[model samples]
Target: MGIFKRVKHMATADTNHFLDKMENPVSMVKQYIRDLEEQMGQAQQALAQQYWNERRYEAQIEETTALIMKRSRQAELAVDRQEDAIAELAIEEKLRNQEKLALYKTQHEATKNQTAALLEQMKRMNEKYNELVLQKQNLLSRIRAAQAIQASTAALQPYDMDRVHHGLARIEEKVWQVEAQAYAGIKAGEVLNAAPSYVEQEKRDEIQKELAALKEKRGTV
Candidate 1:
């Protein structure tokens, strides 16, 4: 069987049914492309063999034709020498050669036709295989793009804005509490540092007594 016949069989198959039966369409397409490549290789080998067979048949035809011509000349020479027995023998040989030549010619024609047909089939198969490869790549790209979109949509679907807002508010409140504590510590430290010394307090009391005595002298005690 030739690859073309197999390709024809595939062409007639129900593609939608096949896809429905498959667990993964992408993997199936990949496998189909591989099969096409393998078939193409086989088809090439078969085409080469057909060509060789055609050449062999042509060589046989040519050799048989030469033999037929030689035998005919021998028969003519025997008849010219007046040898009936020899002439009859040469004639029989010529007839046999003619029959073989006819058979070879028929085989050559048939082989030539077959070779041409196989070559054409192989050419078509190669073209189809290339087309399938391109289609497989495009399909894979589309599948990837669809998966990415689906993933992105899934990520967005479960988002919780309220939860995020509550978390942020809690963090802000903690920051404010830390700031207030820091400010209170700074104010307390400043108050402790600003307390009066003992000498400064005694000078303040002496100034007050002098102001009171001056007031008494002025009869304004």
Candidate 2:
């Protein structure tokens, strides 16, 4: 059986899921460069194998050529001896070997073309990966500048003073309510830590009621 016999096994071999888990752009770019390097290595290895195969084919062709020439010389001797059948068989064997050799020659040419294309692709991938790395650094610097500017602007906002004063007013009112509730509980002869501020609630309610009564009185007038 060939490698990767099970279809499910092939899906796990891909690393896209793991690559997506990386949150940092710089780390992602670095990992991508590593993946490209591995691909480049594999392509170079294939090219080397093709180069070796081509050399083996060249040697095979030379060996076969020498063998044919030697047999042809032998055939000349056989013809002089008038052994026609033996010479015919020898020539036929040479023809078969030459045909096989030509097939290997064509295959070698195809492999050469494939290897050249792979090398070009590897070169392009390397260039693109380098460009991404450079761009990543430039982007990181700009991000830092943007973050610094945002922090500086937040630290120097005029509206922040209003926010602080509003918060302090809320806290002061809560403190006064607490004190009033404690005084009310003591006056009512209750053994309690505190209660809701009756005096403050009453005062705020009376003010609102008087404002409403004044509006009604003016409306009638």
Candidate 3:
């Protein structure tokens, strides 16, 4: 049992390490952006529905206002005709419609306020999303610069001073021999010219310039 437990623990540790290695910051940030986009879409739908509710309340309020006015006029006409029961019924309906109009107005105002709140929330979320995008860009730029620097550093490592000096010594000897031959040919009335040797310093300078440019692009310098 103890051996089995030890094996299980080792397996778990290895799995965790593998999972950690698989986690990429850039991919994670992109996924977060996608999630935010989905949420924004849902929020927009909710806002649209809220606006619909506000409109529905406004329509109800208009209908209630018209009913109140109609009931009031009906009550007046019934009184003029000496129909007391009809007048009473119209007055009751007028009062009921007035109450409904007030309620509808209150509901409409609340819906409008909720819509505004939703708009503000969406504004804040959009701002946050933009900020995350900027951060992701900066992170990517830095990663690329780091990778370039690492490769350049590795390439330079093999060309250390000892190796460089040894290589230069051989080239210098070869150049000296070439010069001696050229001088001998010249003395014999024959001109001999050798092409220039490769310049390692220029290549080193170019690599350095490339590194500096990458740093600048990454905003590190």
Candidate 4:
């Protein structure tokens, strides 16, 4: 309604149009893929770290279980030797190792589950990313087809073709006029050459007069 408002609206529209033109599908898709790859890489790294923790927990559980067995054997030997102090110490160490083994086992199971879930998530992301790539290819093919059709349509525009035809018609008319002029000149030349010349007709008439005079002179008129 207002001039300033109209100007502002026009400017915004123009900016949006410019941005749309600048937004190339290929570049946009490539950027999107790059971002997806980055995220996937980060996810993979985190999964790898999780797997490392699980392995560490497993190693710790194995070591702790071995220590617990060793302590139990040591406690039994001490008891057989009637060494109460050594047996008590071995029993305490076995209990601590057992606790450590339990904690390690729990952590290992939790980490293993988390790693499995992350792997499934990563698989889904890869599938989706592949689908996006295929869609990009399809989009490009359609765009190319549309561009070709648009170019052909532009070349065959009726108004442009009409102008071409009009130019050809003008040239044809000029050629016809030139041919007509040449034909007219040939006809005129033929008519002039077909008739007797004035000088030749006069010469014939003079010869006839002379013959009549000669006959009269001879008295054979």
- Where is model 2 more than 4 Å wrong at Cα? 1-23, 159-221
lDDT of 2 by residue, 1-221 (tens): 22112212322334345445667755776766676666667667767887898788788778877887877887788888999998898888878877877887787788788667666665665666566567568757977998999999999877778889999999999999999999987878653324447667888999999989998989952
lDDT by residue (tens digit), candidate 3, 1-221: 33224323322333223324556867766776786676678778889999999989989998898899899999999999999999999999999888888999999999999898778777766776786688679768988999999999988875478888999999999999999998888876532222122356677889999999999999999
Would you list the rank order by lDDT, best first?
A: 1, 4, 3, 2
Clashes of 3: 0
Local error of candidate 3 at residue 133 (angstroms): 1.5
Q: TM-score of model 4 relative to the true fold?
A: 0.72
- Residue 100 C-alpha lDDT in model 4: 84
Q: What is the C-alpha RMSD of each candidate to the true structure, in Å?
A: 5.0, 20.0, 30.3, 10.5
- Candidate 1, clashing residue pairs? none
TM-score: which is higher, 3 or 4?
Answer: 4
In the range 144-208, model 1's lDDT, one tens digit per residue, is 99999999999889769899999999999999999999999999988777665656778889999
What is the lDDT of every predicted structure here? 0.79, 0.71, 0.78, 0.78
Q: Which residue pairs come into collision in candidate 4?
A: none
Candidate 3 CA-lDDT value: 0.78
Candidate 2 matches the true fold with a TM-score of 0.57
Top lDDT model: 1
Cα distance off (Å), candidate 3, residue 35: 0.9
TM-score of each: 0.70, 0.57, 0.62, 0.72
